[model samples]
Target: MTSMKRVLKLCLGSARGAMVQGGALTVLVLLAGVGLLALSGWFITAAAAAGLAGAGLAFEVFRPSAGVRALALGRTGARYGERLLTHDATLKALVAVRLRLLRGLMSQPLRRLERARAGAALNRLIADVDALDGVTLRLFLPAVAGALTLLVSVIGLAVLVSGTVALWIGAVYGIGALGIGLRFGPQALPVARRAERALQAVRARTNDAFAARADLTVYNALDRQIAHAGHAATELAKARAHRDGIERAAQFWVTATVQLAVAGALGLGFMAVTNGALSAPLAMTGVLAALALSEALMPLARGISEFGRIADSARRVMGDIPETVPELHPRHDAKPMVVPPLDLRSVAIRPLIDTLSLTVEAGEMALLAGPSGVGKTTVLNVIAGLLPPDRGKVCIGGTPLTDHAEEDLRGRLGFVPQRTTVMDGTLMDSLRLGNATLTEAEAWHLLDIVQMAGFAKSRDGLQTRLGSRGNALSGGERRRVALARAIAGRPPVLLMDEPTEGLDEATATAVLKGIRAYLPKSAILIASHRACDRVLATRVITLR
Candidate 1:
């Protein structure tokens, strides 16, 4: 499919639930609008005909009063329905887009996402999605409805009065509004793109300033940072202003051209009446109908302008989502291996900066001792399927790690990084990651296993709330909670980084003891500089 089709498909897929309601409402609104316009023309025609017949035009004189009233009611009802459906669909689409973005981020490596400007992603998710409201809700349905309404109104005018004059008015209005509006599509899209970029830059700069607020305050550079933020905001405002200006200019030209076309049609209509080709009442009705028909183009003009903005914003956001990730596939269709325990064979780890090789057999507890700059964590990442090897294979039970799907590989291992990232939730919520179906007893059991039972008991047990990033808990508590979660899953392979860092000697010893208790059943690989002779691994690899 083409790129535009693909983007639209993605949007529809996300908001499929809402699209049902929106589509129904859109149909109703269009019907109502058409009815209202037709009733309006009838009112004008009836009033003109009554006056020519020498009877004072009265509301009771119109034969189709009931139809007019129904049309008016339909217009009101359809407007409400359209608003309800459009809002529902737009919100649903936004949610779907948000979920897709999150999934994309998860599939990509942290390094790649980090390399992108933080503000750009945020702007796409927030502002860009907001911009799409008009496109999905207003642009497609209204433009189509307006075109059809214009056509029918023009045809009705031609049948009632001068056909040539009606045709001329229709052509001018259609070309000036729909055609000229389309011409501005390309011009306005770039402005929307620029606006999106500028907004992202502003968000990124503000985020950076907030993240470094402490440092900025200490260094007395807060004012400088604030000034920089103002500059970014100004840039975004300027881009938005330019886009709005272009849209306004396009709208004005369309309105002016349509009005001029109506005047010309009226002139032709007057001559036709004077020459006895058409009745005075018919001529008056023709002029009034032409003006009404021409007005339908207004929505088309506005929709085209708004569509350009929506399409541009959607493109920007969709483009930012990562499209590629390294895939791992074994050379052969290897059978799944069932061995006594976890094992790594011919495992070579190559980080962005360095490379290393190692192997660990089942029932072995190994500690990877190295300086801060070494490829210690990189080695663990390879085992966890987070990173791909440069030239070697990671195997478990003689089965290449790459041979297994990512979900299967993940099921076989447990990982705890140096900086524990605690989600915003209760303590039990974090522990539930190990096993979503874990029972209350099982949760407390794992907390006991990690020597965190006392900590949980001290608080409100598993019900204790944790702040965002676990700010409510200390670094040591966060590490223990993460460790408890990793071990709770009871995977056969455990990879830990600085599990004992920042903990007191007594707490560190207790945490190490708990980890050692699981070493007999699981192959444990830890990266740390501190030596624990009591829980020492059977083998240790020291890297420079």
Candidate 2:
């Protein structure tokens, strides 16, 4: 019903097969351990009783000893196998989760993305996804294994001893231990979730303090910021302590129930032995069984406490994710065509542009000039289909933009904006964003067109690794690099938004010349406020 439930259910379905395998191994491990302990108790007790009665020589010890040894080995092997299987399955599930999250984000509407609070949403995407990684490993597998352990233990006791004894053991373990664990589990959900959030808050504060240390020192608030971060950490610690305290208490209650079950079995076994309904060796076996089962059941409390945290993680990770949209698959069958002319019909975007229509044909350059905040960039975005028009439509090559999938259409479009953001990677990596398979020679040629050939050649060339945000390059160089990337694919529609905003007149002129020379036949639309940009345009459109 809820986002958390939906996400958890989806993940469970995906990982169910692996979960079953791991759970089966876990159940084997627990059963073997309990069986070994019970057999050892019975054999030792029987041997002592027989020796005192002068029948030690006739008592069989070899078979029971071999059985104990076999069970011990089996338990050890199953425990190891369980760890390996569960961890591998969990890792595979996490990979699936990340892929699904990426697809979800890609398919989300741009408008919705814009509306989300950037920092909080981004934090949830990273942290919450990581938190959900433990769901399959810790909660689901353990709970299932615990259930299997209870079922097998109860059934065995019924056959070996009495139905009354089996019911007693089951009621104590199932109704007492497991019931208490489950009852207290939901209470920890809110507290544990709050603690997790508080921890995130502390981390965020610490990062902020480190990132802005210099600014804080300059403004004489460095100590204050540090103190604030310390306060956040303290709050996080308190929340964690409270959640852990609740978990500890639940564990105590479950442990007490287990002890009670063991005591009950021992007392009942004594009475049955006295009445000749049960043997002394068999009585010892039942007591040992209860003891071993306690070991298996106590962890149920921990698993129950973890349920809240996992549920919270699922909710956060999947809650904000928008509904899936139609995926844009590559159309390999579609033949490549010439770049189409860009057209806008009855385009009205609020107070910025009203009833505006324009077309930029091949080999033509259109300049859009307006004062600041006039939505020049918005117009470029609309035409690029990054944003849809409030009214009217945009067409390229006589096809409405809506008719083509975003991924399929974007391959044929080249866009360069005012601020160039280059990733921290090699020069080739940056250029490859436009065309992944572009050769080194073609990359060099594009760089030359943008006047970066000499600079790149003298340095590491295409292999040069740039600093964060491409800060290693000058403002002009970064812009040129972005321009080269945009033109690398030689797309039909080229949209430039304030290309020469932060450049000198000479640099801006060279940049415009590079564009015209590189993409001579592409339908180019440049939104700029500079008069020099208008001069290079074959036609200029002005907005008041």
Candidate 3:
């Protein structure tokens, strides 16, 4: 909750003036609506009274009619401007907050980010951040505007009508509004939160069902996966329906309360008119104002219903982020070492590889060849600084691994893991992740090197959108895409775990040749047991 408050403070503090102006406009729009109704009622009642008293011609209609017209037009314009400013400001704030959250997630170690980037972590990106977007519009602004409008209308009634009438009407509204909130606010919160959880489950379950479709089919469990997904969907639907029911029930109470207040005010207005303490027009003004106040109270119903989910989402999201995020790239004054391009000294990861040492210098290709479970990928991780070795030092260009900043390591080194997956973006977007300023010509050149230029051009060229995990492309094409990405900038040190795993001998040889031609000075290391890969290795170090 404190985190949610901080996020709101950040949002409003950043755009205080615009949000304030929008809130004021919201108040004006609602106030004008109330005033318009009251004045219109008074005009009709007074004009009729003047006719009965045989002085209708002497009564002024132009000014009252013109005032009504102005209020109506002004309310419409103010409403439009209010919506535009507030929504625009909220959207801009959402962008900044999302970026902040993304940066926060990236601030974690690469291991965690790698593990969480797919299903659940993605919710933080699309669903969770979006859940809090309505905080200002649905809750804060409407709440302030609603309270102000109600107060101002009650005060107006006191001045323009009987004080006793104003007192009773205000009491009825104030009590009713409080009663409704107190009654449903707590009850609706938990239900709304459950709905949001169910929604997340639906997303995760649906992704799981599709992602493991092959395994499920082979195991004769596809029906069970489908059932799981269907159950999650059903749960989400039920939760949403429950939340809507709560909202509608609250609306019912709000309407009944408003009607009750209007009726009492109308009864009091008749009595006041009979006693001659207030004119018919003035009595009608109070009655109509009481009725118009309903609009101001309407927002409270929605605010109550959404209160739990938005606040929870905000708290959880913001709570994960610290008040200050340290610099992602801490500058290093250390110069590059004149040693091998890749070096590891006495590295150990328990039984995986004890006291292992190796180096791959510039323009050399070192293949780590071993049988399965020989800690092949784990050694690559240590070289990439992804997993710190238990007892040894890893260095890049003579600089200790810990000394290099994230940006520096990424800039100087490239590693393609055994299990590669594509991000949800275009082919160009994936390529640009490696080199942000990469152009179409360069992208095509790299694709041509990987023998994927025809595949890309066959679809939508560089702009072709790949589905989740590159489902849009074949497995071989996806592997090639990862190869192209890893070597996009032609980094000085390249690490590959089965880069040519699925490719035939002919294509693998050509791809390997392209990599060498593109980066002749680079130190390339491969973790492969394939004979085809062993053919071109300048040196092969077989792990025991």
Candidate 4:
């Protein structure tokens, strides 16, 4: 609950002023709506009674009718303004929350980040964020409006009608509204939360089925995926149906409260009229006011029932976020430096590569040849500052990686992970990602160094559009493009994992030479299985 409050505060703080104005307007809107209903009821009842009593000309209709019109217009305008302010502000707050949530997720260590970023967890993160809309827009503002409307309506009744009318109507209406909330909220909350989860499950399952369609089809297991998705959908339908039933029941209770309170007001008003203590018209006003006030408080009941869903979303989002976010990425104020030696000292990430120290200086290519699962990629990840080594320090230019921010420290190095990822964009955009200022001519030069100039020309030159993950290009082309992108910045240190994996022996040897020729002073580290990679290296470090 404390964490949920914190998350809500963060969202509300994003647009505090607008949210405040929206809330105030919410109260005004509901009050105006009640005033409109009550006034209209009084005008109709009083005019009809005066005509029956042969005194139609004695009753003034203009002022009351004018007041009704004014209240009606005011309510409409206020309602519009309230919607605009609250929704706009909430949208801005949602954007802020989304960025903060991603920043929080990104702060996790690489291993944890990978785990948390699996299809289902990431989908849940997004769903939870979307659900936060219910927090301020549904629960908070409406609750405030409902409570204020009830209080103001009670005071108005006392002044306009009679103290007795005010007392009984207020008691009945307040207790009934609160009772409806208390009755439905607790039972509906967990049910609503379960419904929300079930809905997300449907979405996640559907996405997985489509994503793994090929594998599922190959194994003749597509039906299983469909079954899982269908089961989630069924659960979602049941939960929502239950919530709908609860909401409908609440409406029944609200209507019943309105009638009971109205009946009491009618009883009190008739007695007052019989004794000549109150006019018949104002008596109708009191009864109608009770009806309007009861209806006005209905939003509170719905908001209360929705609290479960909102709290669950806030809790999940807040819980997933780490309080202490490490300053892994460099701040803009951080100073950049030239790349230094890739240094490791007795660095270890248990179960493999234990108690090892190594250094690759500037202008050297040190090949790490090792059997699979010997932590070659792990070493690259450590050097890339993605993974924190369990045992020892990894330093750059005599500065510890932890002390240095990523953009400040690793900004001086180029790292290509084993799995290639290219954003959907043109070839020029891909090349310019590493060095924003890279020119068309410079891009072609790097392409030539990696022997990809022909590949670029065969397509659209620099304008060739790459598909998702650069799937438009072949495996070898993607690798070369990744290599070209990394060296585009010409960092003094370069790390590549199985970089030459798909290329043939001759192309692989040339690509390696081209990278060295392109960055003459760069310190390069290659983790690979190919013999050609070891032959061209300045040194080879083998792992058992």
Candidate 5:
């Protein structure tokens, strides 16, 4: 709860001016509404009494009529302004939250990010971020606006009517609002929170179902996945219905409490009239004020009911962020280490790569050979700086790898992992990973080297849109595209993990031939368990 408050404070602090302005407008809108209703009731009663006394023409009706018009216009205009400012502030806060979330994720270790992708983390992240808007729009603003209306209405009644009568009215209305909060607020909170989780579950399952549609169909389990999504949706709907029922009941109780208060006021007004202590017009005004105050207080119950879920969402969003994020500003003084004989001196990774020492000199193609569990890929990761060595050091050009920033190292090394990662974008977009500024001509040249130029040009040229995870292309095609992307910038030291794993024999031979011809002067290290990879290597390092 404390953390939730902290997050709310941070959000409010980001757009304090707009929030405060919107809050002030809301107060004005509520006050205008109450004033309009009270004035209308008093005017009608006063007009009726004057007519009964045969003094209808002598009464001053124009002033009250004009006041009513002014209040109506003011309330409408203020309500519109409040919505505009509040929504604008919310949009700004949304942008801030997204930026912070991206920064937090980027600061985490590569392994953590990789693990997070296998679950529903992305769906939940989006849901939690959007839920924050409700906190500002529904909860905080409405609660504050309702309280202000109550306070001002009570004070006005006390001045217009008798103090004793005002006290009774305040007690009834205040107690009714407080009771609604105490009785239903806590109950609806947990239910609303459960609904949020249920909804997230439904969203996650739906996304998974779509992403794995082909596999599910092939395995004859498409119906099973669809059933799972349906079940999650049913649970979410049930939870929402329960939470809403509690809110409606609370609203009904508030309505009844206000009616009872109005009845009591009418009785008191009759006694005052009989005793010649209060005017009929003023008594009517007091009753109308109670009704207006009830309307203002109604939304408060809904806001309180929603408070718990938004708080829960806030907690989930901030839960994974480190206490302090690493600074991501580009380092002006850092540059990629030039020259190479990529060297790992006595490197040891827990349960893998035990006390390994190796060197891949410039212009040489080195192969990492081992059986299935010998950490061939792990060594490549360590050299690529994705995994920190438990002992010993990795150096390039006699400079320790750790001495260079991660961004700087990215330019000096080209690493293609075992898994293919191709997001939904145009062909040019995916091919520019190694170099953002690469021109279409240069990208096509690289694709031609990997024998994908004809394929890309025949489709949409540089504008070919790939589906999510490059699902539009086959396994071999995706692998070749990834290779083209990695070499687009002509990285001096290449690290590939089973680059030919998914390709046919002829395609794999052409890929190796292209690499040798295009990058003859660059050092290359390939991690593979395939015996066929040995023929292309200048030297093979066989792990025991």
Candidate 6:
């Protein structure tokens, strides 16, 4: 319950600004609706009492046009206000939720994150966060506003008319609408969950297919893969159809029940008029007021049904994120570390499933050479502060890496993983990931060192766009570009995994030479299996 409350609070905090605006608009609309209904009842009663005489006929002529204009203005204003506030809140909440997810992932160990698929993480970030947009804006606020409107309107109408009449009207409208929501709410949950799962599966499968497009084409299995995607999409549509059908059935029953209750009220009003207990105009007015009051509850019922679906999706999304990320805590008396430049005292890291310990010193380029699956990249991640050792202490400049601020520690080291993760941007944008303030001259100079100057020269220098995953450039060129990015910041320490994997002999040598020239003072650690590459290292630390 406490966790749920915390999540709600986080969501509300993001949307509070828009809630204020929406709440105000909701109040105005409720007032306008009540006023319109009351005034229309009074005017109709007056016209009936006058028996269509001269003044009565004139009153009827002006009242309807006046009511229509006022109602139109109120509805238009309310809708505009509601839309403005809801959209603003939706966007704000999405941003907050995304940031929270990112912060959570950042705190976890690299190996744990790797265990979670990339597509799953991406789905959580994009689709899961998007789920909350409807939750807060379309579902929560509107439902709350509608309920308030019904309550206030019912109380006001009771004061204007008989308590019994108001009670009958409120009960018929409110209970019917509430019943509709309750009946379909539970059924909607399964459908929503299945739909969300299907969407995630589709996303993951699509990503896998695209990543292995060449393999699929070579094996002539492209048609089969496409058919699989079609099936997933079909499943999603079926789930949606099922949920909608249930909701529609609920709405149908609720509407029928409300209509029967309204018919009963009108019959009672007519009998009262004939018996002289109520006037003819009063009877007609009472019937109209009851119908209008009942209609107002429809939006509330729809909002509740939508909210149920959002809640279901929210549960699934939150469950997908690992609950292990530590909450941020502030320190009062702790000062930043100020000591030796870099220090690693007997640091030993062994994988949870393996038995090996690797250690290195500052200002030394140690190459971890071993067969595949020996956790070479994992070892580098541990050293680069991207992963925490299971049973070892990681200290830099005499302070534990965990104790130091994450941003400060990250600034002290550079890491380029085996898989190239390039954002959708120009070459300069990619380079800026290393150091945002890297000057144009310095960028070109670094490119020259990596033998990429000619490529940049052929293009339009820093403005040249690089395709996704560095697809625009050759394999060796991509490796060099990544290398240049790693050393751009000239951090105190550098960690590289398979740095020369795709480079040709000449380009490989040039990349090695560039690392030596640019990072002459920084501690460089490269993990590779190439014997020729080991010759460029200051010291080789081989792993089994």
Best by lDDT: 3
The residue-by-residue lDDT of candidate 1 on 135-243, one tens digit each, is 5655654665567666766676677667887788778877786567667777777776676666666777788889899999999998898898898788889877887
> If ranked by lDDT, best first, what sequence of candidates would result?
3, 4, 5, 2, 6, 1
Go through the candidates in order and give each one's C-alpha lDDT: 0.71, 0.81, 0.85, 0.84, 0.82, 0.71
**TM-score: the better of candidates 1 and 6:** 6
Give the deviation of candidate 6 from the true structure as CA RMSD: 3.3
- Candidate 2 has an lDDT of 0.81
Judged by whole-model lDDT over C-alpha atoms, candidate 1 comes out at 0.71
The candidate that achieves the highest TM-score relative to the unseen native structure: 2
Q: Which segments of candidate 4 are over 4 A away from where they belong?
A: 49-55, 300-306, 324-338, 449-463
Greater TM-score among 2 and 5 belongs to 2
lDDT of 2 by residue, 258-351 (tens): 7988899999999999999999998888888888887677776676666677778787777555545344586565444446799999999886
Q: Pick the winner on lDDT between candidates 2 and 3.
A: 3
Put the candidates in TM-score order, highest first. 2, 4, 6, 5, 3, 1
Candidate 4 lDDT tens digits, 71-106: 999999999999999998888888877777777877
Report model 2's TM-score to 2 decimal places: 0.91
Instruction: Write down the worst ten-residue block by lDDT for model 1.
Output: 323-332
Clashing pairs in 6: none
Question: What lDDT score goes with residue 396 in model 6?
Answer: 59
Is 1 or 3 the stronger prediction by TM-score?
3
